[model samples]
Target chain A: MNLHHAPSSTPLVEMVDIEKHFGGIRAVNGVTLDLYPGEVVGVLGHNGAGKSCLMRILSGAMIPSKGQVRINGQDAQIHSPHDARDLGIETIYQTLALADHLDAPSNLFLGRELKTRFGSLDDGRMMREAVDVLKRLNPNFKNLSDPVSSLSGGQRQVIAIARAIYFDVKILIMDEPTAALGPSETAMVSKLIKQLRDDGIGILLVSHDMHDVFELCDRVVVMNKGKNVGSHRIEDVTKDDVLSLIIKGQLPDDWVPRSQETVQ
Target chain B: MAETDRSPPLVGWNLKLSASSFHKLSALFTLACLIIVFSFGNPAFFSINNGLTVLLQTAVIGLLGIGMTLVIITGGIDLSVGSVLALSGTVTGLCVKAGIPVAPSMAIGVCVGAACGLFNGFVITKMRITPFVATLGMMLIARGVALQLTGAAPISRLGEAFGVLGNGSLFRIIEKGANGFPKVVFPGIPYPVILLAIVAVAAAYLLNRRQIGRHIYATGSNEEAARLSGVAVDRTKMIAYTLSGALAGLSGNVLMSRLITAQPNEGVMYELDAIAAAVIGGASLMGGIGNISGTMIGAFIIGVLRNGLNMAGVSAFIQQILIGFIVILAVYIDQIRNRR
Candidate 1:
């Protein structure tokens, strides 16, 4: 795959030596990953392989027991989802993280609500903006006032995407973006990922789908049992090599690890 | 997959009158029917004097219902409101008897109520106690404190000026008599009714148009999702409980002023009435659904039934049973509408 950034540029996000312990269980133990501008990095792992746990720490849902997360080479302190939003980090959780009873516009502007001069919620202006962003993402989208619980799964996913892109997002973390979607909806998401990547946004895509990683990711990192098995360019490693690494946490004898002069 | 097939719009614009509003309209209809039937039962029930009297009687419960609406919308219960009302009244009565001005003394009463609410919020949020248990404990503690303060007796003999707040009417007309002396014409809307109206309007604005209102609803609807979306769930819940407490305090003062005394054992089982008013007006106990107009109508419904039944020679015992049945019927209807 073609490199999106020059080697001299600093990585947008660097999480080094991350460790997370839940009592006796070390969910994530000593893993490191780097993401650069305009690149999609796929994190592939089985259930309980620590992919979700590691990403949760970066998303500010959980704090790292031992690790340093640097943004633009500067050490950051993120203790909550509010702090993460201030640093332009938005996470689209697998559950979608939406209040099911609120309307479309209310959910789209849940945290970052726009207020009129008189200090009331600018519902009219918010509805207009929601219409603008949602139409571009899903042209068939309607019912701006209906509760999100009444929406279809694909439409709800589009609303969640609208929320992330509606703000000034620098780093987007998506956990299983298409896990519950149909084939057409999945294709729609793949198209959206490419569109966002081309627009110079850094994304951390965590999934168990091999085809999604091969088609949309530039670099793929495999994790097994809380450890990084290997990292390779999508073009350098075949589907079977990545599969073997994910299952056994072992790299083939003939395969060389990707160079990391720029990563460290 | 046939998953692409969209369900025919379950809520159309014509039918888009949300289930909440539809329930509100139905409640209004029920209230109108009750008035008509009672008026037929007794001619006095249809008079303007009786209408004003019913509203005056509803003022205390209406105030409590305002706070109850907020608490219920956040999916929490405040069983201590009635007891807090008694405590606030006793505190204010003591302050007035101690030579403090009535206005500031009343303000102190409301503040005392707010403090109790703050304690309840702290216990529920920081201490991680469930709201039902926390407020239930507060109910007993506040009632006990009120009883201890008054030594199981009522405080009375407050000055005449203190009674004006609850008994006076707005816009009283004065006319020059034949001998050039001012003469009383008409007594306008009662003070407590006007106060209830003002509080209801303010609470409605806060719930429908403000940021905190959204936070309260979101927190009640799905707390984990709200937290992940950057809402201050703890702060929102605290505010709801605090507001509920303040309103209860205000109600205590109004009731005391009207009766010209503060009874240590007053407001017993009053919490049940406040909760009933909210539920009857369409505020779901499950939270994330309610409105002030509905609650006000609900308060009036209870007041009219009680007043009209007394006039019609029905015993208070039967009235209680009927009100209880009405509460159950309202919730059951809400459940059926939601299922559709």
Candidate 2:
């Protein structure tokens, strides 16, 4: 992905020293991360590397055992997904978070549905808007009224992405957005991520795929064993460099994050 | 933005008919076949008198099926419906016998049913009990209460007005016959049949056009997903079980009126009939699918089969066996359809 980053923008979101423990086990520890407008920041980690744990805290699906999450430079309490959405943070989960029996419009507006003047379900309006949003991502998609169960993995992912974008997403968190897509579908999703980045939306992409991280991200955040190793600009870091950070939990000695450059 | 090295997405449209639609249509076909076979077997089965008789018989079970449809659509079941029915009807009968006004007594009966539903909802939602277990407990509790309410005796000699609700007919006409004797035609529609129609219309409207309807379907389809999506999962589930209780109450009242007495055993095993009717109507036990029209048709099919079999001198025992087999078949077909 050829991502053009606009320098020195306000932080759209920041999680400071987030810590989470499930029973006696530490799932995430002292992980701090942030996003700025018009940037696709890849959150890279191997399986069970606290990648999802950290994102869950930001998504309001789980409360951190300790730490603070701030949106737009203000402290935010994300007690639930509703709270996260209210903060303009939308999470398109890896599993898609869709009811298989429900159609696209229903899933897109599952929690917040459009209503007619007299208060009936404004399905027609929801469908039209869903078609519009879906067309932008995958114009060839046609099964607007069919349930997600009838859809292929690629189509379901597109629907999930449509749901996040339908809302005014300021900080989009996509967990493995192209895990189920074919080569062509992956390209479509790769391009969609770029389009969202161009739209001035800050995205936190959680991916284990190196190609996805290198192609779609402007900046990369690596995590290993419940801790953030480091963040680096894609141009300044190689795939092997990020891989070493993911595997060894240490950054290259000469490399410095832009945030750290000012302090030193 | 990076350009992808692939052809543009191939946009195409195909209107594929869903499997659920096919199953529901198949239900209609079954009902048609039942009608044809019965008509050929018994000449009386095709008569208007028998038709009304079948419709009247269907009314109580049909009402119960309406509530069952809602509950089943939300992926819940109410096993206490039969017990609740008896209790509601007995309460109404006792009230009427005590010289309370008929209208208020009947209203109280319906309220009793709704209250039982609310209690079931409370147990299932607040107590965090599985709906099947909660309702199963309620079913036994309700049966004991019903038995205690009457000491296993029937509440008899209910008020004239109260009996009319179950036994009375609406829109009757009286005319002078050829012998100049006053001849009175049975009411144009049995009161229960008319009541069933009113309730069915209301239930249909709620299921098809309301926000609550969609929420119920969503909650039933995938509860965790619904909760994450911000649907009030608890409230939607409660409403379904509560509605089931209320409908069972209405059925009990109708049964009491028709029998001209409230017996503790009035609706013994009636839950099976209500559930069977809903299933035959195309409701999925797994939830997220059903329609009132289909349920109505389903109820009629059951009613006609029972009455037709009885008229043909098929013993009641044999009738029960046949109905049980049919219910099994319906559910099996539903499972097969869902598998595909």
Candidate 3:
């Protein structure tokens, strides 16, 4: 079957006509958006506004009932989180999905562990890699062997991000990445996001923090009541505009909402 | 991060050692206390022959307990284990009676046990039956089948070679001895005890070193999380139950061989002992924590207590009451320790 191939200059990640329903409730209606390589796209929506559901679809945690996902111009069929990972999509869930009793290195290598020729896990290599990855992201981090339960919430979040990066993910989907972090840790995470973008990885950031979006994202998409409201370049839209679209389901008159508001 | 860097080497060592080492030490302490109490209560308990006797008696139950530990660790219980034991033993007996070789008969017994476990696994996983209810049903079915197979009578008179498994010693001793002054030649240990030790070691290694072992722990700890992380939760549970059943079957064969008869009612209430041994050994019913050494100690504790009660000439009925009290006390102590 011949599929539509986006031009070389097209965005690295694209969703078209995406729709999802949970019985009678439409969680995410028809929505379409594009994310370019080396760009962070902030998704803004109120609670139950379909931000998480959309992100879940992208992360392969949930499949859309209708629509298509394309990564690097190739059609991606992501039925499970592993499928999403195989397509170079990594998601750091808000819950973190961490094994509390396991140390950082073990948590980072939970399912897809590095093994020696003898087939046993290569702890030395895994620990070294975890240390290196953490150091690169936050030089202050030194406890690679500490169980995540002992770590602060920020540290656990960092380890989750490190896990995604170590797996060579090209697209990172973070759900409320800084929701529970202290101000300092939030700044640290913001810095890390910039560094990841500089390294040319695509990012879909779902957050309630408007400041974080304005500071880090290059573009922003607004969703309201299971429908895409509008997409705007970072410089072209204010936080007020995004907020209005999310809460009011309408953009300011001068900033007319896009006609393709309802997801297919 | 700072905790490890600035902590004194001795303090760090103590902290690290305390977490894992304390559990081992506690188990050993209990074991030592049992040995002392038993030997003090009965002079015969200190004899090597008595030790061999205790080990032989505990072997089948101990083996069943090992598998039960794994199942219990996964937050699941197998009430059907005793029934599976009877069923497998009957199958082995029937096969042997039909002129099947000893090895193949044993294999069939183990296979039958494994099949029963698979059924339990399937019912729980696919049919969404709770482990307790499903295994309870299985218990009745297995026990009924066992009774039906033997026509409600015990099957006896197995080959002498089979009898050697339970009744015969690895080495024979020729001795001329009286109670006060006696010269007794040494006899080798029972092969069953050696077999039990080997099985225990193998179980320890599997639970500690293998990926399959980790999967079992993970499935027990947080099954949804484990499944989300790509661990095959259903398959792991299936393996746990299957292994538990198969081991119970093996234990049954040993029990039958020792008794030289297939007693359908012999294993009644055995699942309770196996579960109690597992729990007392630190295999939490909540799942995600256990060790072979702990279970072995638990088995020894049970064995020694029984021996001590017998030597003390305690009534059989009172022995049961004491055992029940001991099980409760052990569990109560464990809960207190866990809280601390």
Question: What docking grade applies to model 1?
Answer: acceptable
**Residue A170's lDDT in candidate 3:** 91
lDDT of 3 by residue, A154-178 (tens): 7888888888888888999888999
Comparing 2 and 3 on TM-score, the stronger one: 2
> Between candidates 1 and 3, which one is better according to TM-score?
1
Candidate order, TM-score descending: 1, 2, 3
Candidate 2 local lDDT, B1-340, one digit each (tens): 0001111223362434456556667887988898899899989889877888898999999999999989988888888899999989888888888889888887888888888898999988899998789888888888888889889899887757778888888777778899999787654688899999999998887765577877887887888777767678888888888888888888898999898898888888888898999888878788777778878878887998899898889999999999999989988988887787
- Which pairs clash inside model 2? A1-A215, A140-B11
lDDT of each: 0.87, 0.84, 0.80
What is candidate 2's CAPRI-style docking category based on DockQ? acceptable
Each model's DockQ score:
0.38, 0.35, 0.28
Q: What is the lDDT of residue A101 in candidate 3?
A: 45
What is the full ranking by lDDT, best candidate first?
1, 2, 3
Residue ranges of candidate 2 with Cα displaced over 4 Å: A1-10, A252-264, B1-17, B97-99, B179-182, B335-340
Predicted complex 3: DockQ: 0.28
Leading candidate by lDDT: 1
lDDT of 3 at B137: 97
Could you tell me the TM-score of candidate 2?
0.90
